[model samples]
Target: MRWFWIDHFVEFETGRTAAAVKNVSLAEEHLHDHFLGFAVMPSSLVIEGLAQTGGLLVGEHYQFNERVVLAKVSRASFHFMARPGDSLTYQATMQDINENGAMVAGTSHMGDRLQAEIDLVFAHLPSRENDERELFDPADFLAMLRLLRLYDVGRQSDGSPLTIPAHLLQAEQAMEAATDLN
Candidate 1:
C-alpha cells in the first residue's frame, strides 16, 4: 500500500508551482503513538508532504515518463508543531529543472502562519526502450493523479488546461483490457 502524506492539491501550474493540503487529525494512527500525551504531526512527515507536492510537480513536467525520485533534502526547518485540527498547506515552487533533476523550494503553512520551509532535490531515473523497469504502474499512477484532482486545476505554461499524456492514457486502456480478459 502507498502512504499519501498530502490529501489533495489545491493549486498546480505545470513546470512552475504546486500546492497541496493535509489535514492533521487525531484519528490518525501515528498521532496516537507519536506522543503518549500530546498528539502532533511529525516534522519528518511534514517534509514528506512538501516533497510529495514538489515531486508530482516535477513528474508531470516530463509527462510522467521519467521516474522522479527525491534525491535529498537540502534544508528543512520547522516553526511550530502541527496538532490535530490544524490544516497544513504545502506549496512548492520550481527553482530549476533539467533533463537530469530538479530543485524545488517548498513551504508549509497553517493558515497564515508559516510552519516549515524545505528544499528538495529530485533525480530522474534513466529510461530506455529496452529497459522495462517501472518505478510505478502507469495505470495506478494515472488513477492517483485523478484521485488528487490534478487535472481539475492544473494548467500548462501557456495557460491551457492540462490533458492526460498519451502514454498514460494508453497504459490505462491496456490495463483495463487485460482486466476484462480475466
Candidate 2:
C-alpha cells in the first residue's frame, strides 16, 4: 500500500491477464543507494511489480471482494540488470485460480529482451461473519484503480469495457457520504 512498484496498468483482461509498466528513473531514491555508482532496479522490486499486476488481476476476478495476498514465489530468474531510463513491462497470466487461491506466471521485459521470469501464488483470506477487517479502504482502492487506468484499458472476455463492481461503487458512495457528514 505504501510503495507502488508498477506505474500503471497498460492492459488488463478480466479473469485472464494483466500488463503493467514501470519507468525506471534516476530520481528514485532507492536506486541511488542501491549502489555507489551503478544504479539498477532491484530484482525484489521487480518481483513486487509482477505480484501487484497479478494480484490485481486475480482480485478483480472476484469483484475485489477477496483479500488476495501473495502467498509464495514459486520461481524467479533474472536475465539482466534493468538500468535507469529503462521502461520495464510486467505481464502476468493466470495459471489457475479457485476459491482458496490462485497461481500466476509473470515475466518482465525491457523492450523485446526478457528481463525476468517469475511464478507466484496468491491466497485469498477467509471471510468470516465475526471478522470485519478490510485489507484496504474502499475509497482509496477505487481511487487507486482509477489512477492506474484499469478501467481505461481493462476489458471483459466479451470485449466490453470493464464495469466497476457495484459493491465498490456503493462503498465509495458511502465513504463520500460519511466524509460529507464530517
| lDDT leader | 2
What is candidate 2's lDDT per residue for 22-125, written digit by digit as tens? Answer: 99999998899888899999899999999999999999999999999999999999999999999999999999999999999999999999999999999999
Per-residue C-alpha lDDT of model 1 across residues 88-126, encoded as one tens digit per residue: 999999999999999999999999999999999999987
lDDT at 8, model 1: 92
Residue pairs that clash (backbone atoms under 3 angstroms), model 2: none
TM-score between model 2 and native: 0.96
- Residue 52, candidate 1: C-alpha displacement in angstroms: 0.8
**CA lDDT, every prediction?**
0.94, 0.95
CA displacement after TM-score superposition, residue 57 of candidate 2 (Å): 0.4
Off by over 4 Å in 1: 128-130
Task: Give the TM-score comparing model 1 with the true structure, all chains together.
Answer: 0.95
